[model samples]
Target: MAKASVNSPSGPASVETLTTRGRKTRDALLDAARTVFEDVGFPEARVELITAAAQVSYGTFYRYFESKEDVFRVLSDQLFEDIHHRGPSDSTLSPAQRLIAANRTYYQAYRRNARLMAIVEQVATFNDDFRRLRHDHRHQLIDRQARAIARWQQEGLVRQSLDPEMAARAMSAMVDHTLYLWLVQGDEANEALLLDTLDQMCLGALGLDQD
Candidate 1:
């Protein structure tokens, strides 16, 4: 009941039309790609495997993704967007309370997506584009954290001498490294203790809770 067309050949006529079935088939390929990538890791995953998993013809994949990496790039973009959970929404929550909520949400999201996250790290190791992608993602967060710190400094919540960029990067590292170890690296540790420690460290770094 839907319309679709072949985009691989680069024809406007094809791009302008696709059937519902065509859309379904395209989605199947993407879904299958995710499964295959997660199972074998991106480096070893084959397009044939993805096609087989999707129950689609080999030619059908080409109609959509130009290559394995193309499909992977699409999947990676989606996953990275979801990697960080939203910040606090409760306007009444104290800054410390908001930090705790944000940290908790981040930890939970990371745990759920650990497998894909691990693959992202592996892919970034040798792939220049993915490496840059990872760096840019971090850089963005650093900027946000720096802005937040600057605001806190103005409110006299944190020391004025604290460098916003430096502090943000440091605290961001603290949370990222800790979770990467516990979730991605499968380090053995008490989950509650780990999260508690993260909360304490972040709060102290922000000069929220101190002696």
Candidate 2:
């Protein structure tokens, strides 16, 4: 099994050193923190409330997390990881089809986690640490996509004239900003139609329409 861990202000130095029981307590706090953050938003959230929600004592909470923000940061890290997640490759699909599939996956994930994402956006406004974290994560996603675009160029799918790095950054930003408007800004859209339009835009950029 593959596991992913993140390093952040809220993350532990290492979780692998913890006992199984300690890990369970840490996970429970994180799960409870997610509910509380969504219910009350990050700024208004309290460690007491989280401990109450988790059915754990204050001492138990402190044993795992230093403060409410600590738990909240961990929760945000997990959600961000989920947002950046990639599904297994489908070799049968064309490059265009693969791009469509990846976009759909991202859109649906954003929709599911929209409220939390909105809160993250709000918090990042005044929180330099969080803003930096979000920027780093965004670039990481762009870099991943850029590598894919470079491969398509090598395979003679995308135009060799296009710079994969710049194209990937632009394309990822297009999707991110579009979805942020639709999801966080409460813009109404038909999902199927929106995805179709996005597919057309992406395919056109890749010159898949010419092929």
Candidate 3:
């Protein structure tokens, strides 16, 4: 037998190729995990199922992540990042206008990703990692809304009795409940109807005459 050359590109090429393949394999595993989580939910979902679905080996899974929850955290962060991809903007518009813009953006997003949103909410209810993310995001959103409410208060547009923090949380709750009802009821409440109803509710809460 001819002496094998240790310095040949063939030997090095095999290692380089495997390294590249490993990255592709990791991405595929994450993608498969997201799909499985969406279908079966986080609590009921299993790593073996995700790896099997991706056709990746158990050892490969360990090389990428410590546990299924690690993958879940990545997915949760990506989901929020996608939701905020539009970017948040501060407005010089009136308080009510700001409210409408914010509410409309949320409504549009919910309509586009109702299933994903529902799954995220369900998962957050049970998963501590997801729950922390959910709470953190909600706090950020409410803080932004509270600042908007404060602006209106400074302008004397809204009643002084209106508490910005409380108002923001109330508005968030209203939007959440409305979305839940719409999702569970199958179009029983249309967007236009929801907008009108929310407008009325918000105006009443803010002590503003409908304009």
Residue 164 in candidate 2 has what lDDT? Answer: 87
Give residue 13's error in model 2 in angstroms: 8.9
For candidate 1, report its TM-score: 0.87
Q: What is candidate 1's lDDT per residue for 148-185, written digit by digit as tens?
A: 78987898888788999999899988888888888888
Question: Which candidate leads in TM-score?
Answer: 1
- Tell me the tens digit of each residue's lDDT in model 2 across 96-149: 888888888888888888888988888889888788878888888989988998
lDDT computed for candidate 2: 0.80
lDDT for model 1: 0.80
The window of 10 residues in a row where model 1 has the poorest summed lDDT is 1-10
Q: Which stretches of candidate 1 lie over 4 Å from their true place?
A: 1-7, 11-20
* lDDT (10s digit) by residue, model 3, range 95-161: 5665666667777776665666777788787667678888897888788778877887898888898
TM-score of 2: 0.86
- Looking at model 3, the pairs that clash are none
**How much lDDT does candidate 3 score?**
0.72
Clashing pairs in 2: none
